[model samples]
Target: MTTQISGPRGLPLSGNLLAFRKDPLSFLTRAASEYGDVAHIRMGPSRHAYLISNPEYIKEILVAKQAHFKKAKGLQVAKLVVGEGILTNEGKDHLRQRRLMQPAFHRDRIAGYGDIMVEEAVNHIEAWKDGELLDIHHEMMRLTLAIITRTMFGANVSSNADEIGHAIEVGLQYISKKATSVLDIPLEVPTKGNRDFQQASELLDKTIYAIIEDRRNEPEGAEHTDLLAMLLAARDEEDGTGMSDKQVRDEVMTIFVAGHETTANTLSWTWYLLSQHPEVEARFHQELDEVLEGREPTVDDIPSLPYVNQIVQESMRLYPAAWMINREVVENVEIGGYHFKPGEILMMSQFVMHRDPRFYDEPDRFKPERFDGGELLKRNPQFAYFPFGGGPRICIGNNFALMESALLLATIGQRFRISRGENEPAAIPEPVVTLRPKNGMKMTIHKR
Candidate 1:
């Protein structure tokens, strides 16, 4: 006899879609808490979705038996924004792209980008005035966007930062909407959403293609250390052929979208968390002061400042940028002793699992000490703490993001502190393609 999967009941036609759309974070978290390890949810009349909260089962889906699944519907819709880039690619194509791009993200190469990250963080905040109220989320977004463009693409987009940021925002919002909508509206339908998405896509293409063309027109053998240059020159060891312009564009777009948005959100959330927790913030400051001795933090300083890393880890646990990862069954597979058919969706939420009290002491509280000496991770299952997704599809820029976040925190924390206003309400987490602080994170900036 097969075990029955139970979940929250839903409306006949729309199923749980309405509940999910209303408050995805709360809904998913509640489902996992109430329904045990695996909760069945109906997205539409025909679409079946399962919320997988058990770490072992999550490991099976994302790592062990990952071959049985493909990128879920959200990512499929993301192809409109990223093309056939690694984020949306599967099978052999995904492997080939990963192989080709692996060298650029190697530890040595990533270490070289640290100085750029610090320099950008410094330059980006040079104009901040003490006591000035600012939307720190927007500030971090601009800073990270500048860093990614310079460090990876070797392009200067500071002049068009707002335009590029707006375009990216439009693309993400469109993907988030389409991913959940019951209607499979074609882009050619000329609906308002479709038209806005098309415009955003065009702007991104123009910006990326312009960058590619500029690199191609550089003097023959002109040396460039950026990821774009590497991609232009790389050849498959087996095929001895370089990527086409479109292939390069797709990868760049993926990096441009995935790379900066996530780190910016992380930094934004870190600052917010620090502001809310004074004791943790004080300890964070003490660590930076003792380690850096009033100097700027470098990649080398990261190892010495364990507390800085802990703060970031704790922040991600509270506000993971990529809150949920979804996978669609491509082949029938049995997981956690339950059989799932092809086309069914598996949902794994970092937000939900990260806060599960079963694996955490005071899971809702922001306690950086929980990760002291990385003992908590050892005591728990691997999937219990995956801010970055697991297995082969884990974030390619995980190291880069971690280094950037810590360095930025140490660097900026030494110079300034952002505090929420006494009258200001807490920032709410908006569940879009990324978990962003809705209405932006507005706080007063103070010199340390």
Candidate 2:
């Protein structure tokens, strides 16, 4: 009973590492092209990884048999960056955190946040000078940061935005570097990246703790209605108790970093996509002109702007912010005829799957029309287009993220045409923590 399951490989120890290191997407694509869909590769010393792209198989793993997998083996880095919020919890703790945080992200609560989304988008768009060369990435980041501050923590929070934003970015750098590095240092033994992470966390912690202290003084009422207030009002169903100060801080940290920067990057990619296609841009404007008469987009208007929604969907399909996620197999599992041992790591490649030719025609082409009530998008398994992953472990904030992107796209796309500036660098994919535009996406916002 000693049959060996083989994958396309090189020298046993030095397997696939060189190719993967050179260019991750290209390497994974090549491996799948040659070895057939699921391929196994080794990282550094003791890591064994598998690449999975089949939609049915992905659904089987992430959904049907979800209890069999925990988070990937290396999310310790995430805990370090954002503390043990919902993103970093598991088992009973994860379920508990999810329940406590669920009320804050509910549809009605998200609807309340929609007004903040429009107001912030309008304020930012009005201030932009036409033909000025500005990095949309920076602009989007600052705008989302401001929204998080004003809407999540109210007006008093804006003063702390800059300090908090810089810290979270630094923490992201640390987490990504640790994931990619051949060597990673323990936090106790402070290295350069570790120190940066420490300093950033310290700054953010001070600001958040101070805010929590002040919020404790506010009278509990139905009137105060930001995420923070909602969280304060939230109670555990079984125990019937509110989140402690530490739990509140952890969730707040997660919301700020996870909330702001990721949306900023997603919108940045979206505008870049819009700027590249004038025909799509024209259609987006026509939709707005016909529907709202140039008034701001609200939650009520989201369904009518089908093309606007498609445009955002297509943008995320191309430049998904979180490119890959790792899942750990907790028991003996069989996938694609490959039997995996417990503790083996499965790397689901979003960047690879989204661009795969098998599921999409000319997968590399930016075609919003493909998604407008298309056959494949509706008939195919849902996991095939999982920018937010599938099943229960799907990002708890998927609806929130989609709603924000749609409203921002509608609001800005209606009033301004983002023009492709001359002689700027094309987007370079950085495959670390999230797939970010390495060149920072420089474009001009022109008044419509």
Candidate 3:
């Protein structure tokens, strides 16, 4: 015997689709507020979902009973772009791929990429002219893309960076459209949308294959320490077999796309938050100045620069890159005191959870001091501030993103202060393909 969970009433056949599509963040927030923590939501009349607002329930789905679920259908659509990489794969295959790719993201290996991260950030910041307005979102996107290309792929892709990035953006937009829409036409259909998607995807695929092929031809035992080399050279300890070209390609593609996008969004928002809150920006600069003192930031300096890290933490709390994480139930289970069917989906929104009034003081205000001594975690616990997610399937690049963001912030913040460009409206989170600024973030840089 299970209790029925009621949610917002909707029109016949459509359910809450219109409301959700119009403004997903507001809809989710309203649902949680109106129907309590475990609110039932309807995507279609037959397609059901449960928006789990409580952290305990989030912990159950992401960590405790993780084995009884799989990545949601949205990620299934992502397969169109990334193939069966760890992000979209499930069960034994996912476990194997995660284990194989784990070493490449190990802390020591991540630390080695710090120089590239700081160098890229410094180069971009130094290139910025005073009194000139810039789209900070696009700037961070390119900088992070360039850093990932050099650090992960070990290729100097500066010449073709824009082309490669445009292709990836188009492919991602196509996949996002498929995931969000009601009617997904077949990829073979020659609709204008479909043709454009295919062309963009082909360009990205060609780029990835070329990288893999070039790496394969490298001299035996050549000094290659990039992530791609690690994946290519990795062997199953028991069977002593390496991944196939397609396998390598899938993993590289997944990392390449996810690795940069999330961090770029976070940094873009960090700058925005800093621009809006001058006092916090002052503290952030103080920390950077006191620690680095006009010198470029090194990976070793990250530990000493507490305020810089806090600004990043608070910024992510406000606008997480991956705002929503969803999972399809694999077994009948009781969660948060309600019954969920095996095929039903479970969703947790970082944007909603991070801003919950119950968790933080002055939840809407930008106050980095709350995170000063790591008191935010003590007050609320792990589930409250999971910008990168949690559990066995937590983002593998969590450490990498945090370190990269902090280094980039430290390296750039030491030199200039970016304020919102005149007459530009505050960036609204669009929540597509990642939580991107709807109109992009516009700001002006001033030398410190």
Q: Please tell me which predicted candidate would have the highest TM-score against the true structure.
A: 1
Q: Which run of 10 residues does model 1 get worst, by summed lDDT?
A: 1-10
TM-score of each: 0.99, 0.94, 0.97
Candidate 1: C-alpha lDDT: 0.94
RMSD of 1: 1.0
Kindly give the stretch of ten consecutive residues in candidate 3 with the minimal lDDT sum.
Answer: 175-184
* Model 3 lDDT tens row, 1-448: 1678888887788788778888999999899888878888888767788888999999988999888788887899999889999888988888788888999999988999999898888776777998889998989989999999889999877788788778778877787778767686899999998888888788889888998998889788788889998998898776778899999999989988998989999999999988888888888888888888899999899899888888888899999998999999888887767778788899899998998988988988988878988766987967888988899788999999999999989888888899996588878998887998887888898988
Compose the digit string of candidate 1's lDDT tens values, residues 1-448: 1567899999999999999999999999999989999999999899999999999999999999999999899999999999999899999999999999999999889999999999998998899999999999999999999999999998889999999999999999999999999988999999998998999999999999999999999899799999999999988988888899999999999999989999999999999989999999999999988999999889999999999999999999999999999999988899989999898999999999999999999999999999999899999999998999999999998998999999999999999988998899988999899999998999999998
Error of 1 at 412 (Å): 0.5
Worst 10 residues of 2 by lDDT: 1-10
- Candidate 2 per-residue lDDT, tens place, 104-157, comes to 777777888888899988887787887777888878888888888777777545
- Say which prediction, candidate 1 or candidate 2, comes out ahead on TM-score: 1
List the candidate numbers ranked by TM-score, top first.
1, 3, 2
**Total clashing residue pairs per candidate?**
0, 0, 0
- State residue 311's C-alpha deviation in candidate 1, in Å: 0.7
